[model samples]
Target: MQGISMSNTMQRRQFSVLACVFQSIFVALFAIFGEFHNHEEDKHNRVHANYPMFQDIHTMINDAGRSLVVHCFGAYFGLAAAKVCHRQNTMVVDDDESSGHSSELFAMLAKAACTTATFMLSSLADHLGRFNMAHIQSSSLAGGIAIGAFANVILYPHHAIVVGAAAALISVVGHPKILEKRLSIQDTCGAHSLHGLPSLLAGFLSALFVLLYEPSEYGPNFVEQYSAIYPQWKGSGQPGAHRDLRTQSFFQLAGLGLTFLTAIFGGLFCGWVMNWSLLNQVQPKPSYEDASYYLNAEFSLFGNIDNSGHGLGSSNTSIHKCGRIDYRPLDIEAALRAVKRAGIGPDAIF
Candidate 1:
């Protein structure tokens, strides 16, 4: 999604923003939410952090296992982005004969390993030796985000590592600078780099894996093992009725394409709504500047406030003492010269 300029009066419309959020949530819950298979409904009975049964939930609570909270919230944000276009059953699957304790263990370990790999690579990509705390924190979770597409079906931990590394590479290379310039759109938060691109990569990876799936490798009960992917096998009571890999792969790709389409159109519609005169108030004269909306911002930076909450102390060279507070625009050339004198590269500061 493209970033929109913030209005100077946005803070005053807080209630309206809150109401819109609630309305979206309501629509999602009531209008679009649908039935999905539970995690324990498959043959293998494999249990993971994402899908604990009722008894397991109780046990986790008694044991003070907070992992569930992290897993659920992480999965929520990752799944939320694509849930509008895909079915829950197809996205995730229950355990079957092909899966076991080893599979469950590897799945959890894969997520951790992938997350760590992505975090390290992303940090390095941002700065060779120094870590940007914000990018590191956000990029660390890209593995878990990408792995959700085939967490259960991934047979090996090394494959998960590869996927995570690829996600990190895509995110770092496709940073907002490249995307914004190429697309001619502002992306203030780097959503496309952090979330959108990685998820799209995962979708394509899922289709590739589906095409590569081998029934013989899954053993005699492959139908039961992959029933979620080929739902026709759920109760067909047949061995090879609906085992078409190409067809499944096509559907997977189709679902992914549809998801991007919906997100683009839906985002555009919302942006249009937000631009309505009644919704958007006074536009921020200087885009992306907090000073446009923040009162006494210049004063807060260099002086103490008086009882009336105004700056009382003397102003600095960077600020002008007008009838009210007036901030001098930043001196980019002077700042660059200072940075050079300090032996710090301009790229580091930027």
Candidate 2:
């Protein structure tokens, strides 16, 4: 990730936008072994002695990161080349020179930074099992999108840049509570933030940008574009001014409302599809077997549940609830000592 950012920054004209896209892609691919990590008791996983498959998978994950960096680097570089070099007016003929200013860069960079931090917090939330972090990230993204869009369309570069920066700062400071033991890449990835929220901001800003920057042509197209969001309204490209203040307000609100509505539903549907695809591969938690002598019915009272079971108990390791029985409980210090004296013991309880 760092490699891509550095290389892309040198090659890409507007590094900020490329940064945002890369951030999203990383979250999407994190699932390749990022399904489990972060915890109250075991945020750091223990090393396995001879797990060749685990090592192989981990190596593959590292490789993906390097490849992602390279891919995004090339993409950003290409876009920059096209925008500055390939375009017609590459020199003196500047139409509103500040229009192609640094504000766009700042806005995109801020969004990327905030979103990246949100992804990390998302991982923590995944371990803890709370939706609050995700909700906050989504809401922040939505608000930023709206603000950026409005700024882009209604305000100048300086003002737009300032407003965008403030919004992004507010978003990055956010963190989550009520954590679960582990988090999956799917849940942690803040798609709602990067896409729907920003897209919303971009949409309104685009319209507003059109209106403020190109009023004569913008008036007609903005109305059509804004209205097309509704079923009963087929935008008449034959353009007309929004005469009534009430009509203008109604349309703006309608566009924003529909945008949010679609976003939530679309996100849920996508998550469901992905979840279904991985469902069959999911394994249930293991349970201890009853073969141990202590766990046998004959010594149920004296030995406790799994004390003297004949065979090894179930190998299931996952604990869905907050606190489950630990295979190696600290409270069993006395028993553990006795087992050491007897020269017999099993691994710690999970």
Candidate 3:
């Protein structure tokens, strides 16, 4: 059983590495061929026309920081997609004003706070007032995932908070009890709860915001601010002509759906390749245990070594150490037997 488990673990590790590499390659290819928004194209043309001498410098200064910050924060892929759809200039009416930045920051902070708070409360209720440290730690970042779609477009900080709280409740209450159980899926790392579901919720919120968007809110600069959203009215200089809210909403939802489909198909294909017999042949022994790969002289729980490199002068050497308790290689068998004798189940013994 242990050998089988180890083999599966090694296979999973290999699959993960290969999947990431292939996915990155595919994403890079897509980015190269992808269409740019009208505003983005116009901006590019303007940079080339006016800033010919410092075009490269402008690109480095303006674009590099945003990429670096997103990567550094390890933002979810879905969130990054949302950012691409609703760029800063289009998302905020007064991009030049400090109020715009302040509003965006406040929305982000509010969402994070709401998500963390809601997760803690829900967890406490679910666990009968006991908190799971792992869940708590992960929940702290769930808000960022939840708010990513509408982070820039959120009109009110409280709206961000509502989105965050809803995301947390869905993750805590719906994920384990409903999604996983009904679908018979095992989410070992809680990726669905932490990233997947929250991001989907964010996308929904983003679509809702798009539907609620009004051109009048931006006053005279509506065309300049929302050129990406309403590209047809860009050069026409008509702030009166508005983009159809339904059309924009449909596109937003469609993007989310396409992102999910691509991810799913890509993962399935990579997994299929990973399961080939040639790839599965090299299974590492003692797979899950760090002792197989690491040779550090860390503290052991089985026993303490004396100056003569012997475990309390006993011939039976220590396999590992566990706190103050000492267990010899031979004693492990006896301990298992003792545990069995005491009516302890195999799960408890292990």
Q: What is the C-alpha lDDT of each candidate?
A: 0.48, 0.35, 0.46
After TM-score superposition, the amount by which residue 340's alpha carbon in candidate 2 deviates from its true location, in angstroms, is 46
Instruction: Name the TM-score of candidate 1.
Output: 0.50
lDDT for model 1: 0.48
CA displacement after TM-score superposition, residue 223 of candidate 2 (Å): 13
TM-score of predicted structure 3: 0.49
Give the alpha carbon lDDT tens digit for every residue of 141-209 in model 3: 666777765565554445655566576666665445233344433333466667777766766666688
TM-score of each prediction: 0.50, 0.28, 0.49
Top-TM-score candidate index = 1
For model 2, the run of ten residues with the poorest summed lDDT:
60-69
Model 2: per-residue Cα lDDT over 133-208, one tens digit each: 3333353454345353343133233444434433343333332211111221221233323333344344444434
| lDDT: worst 10-residue window of model 1 | 58-67
Q: Over 4 Å off in model 2, which ranges? A: 1-155, 174-186, 192-246, 269-280, 283-350
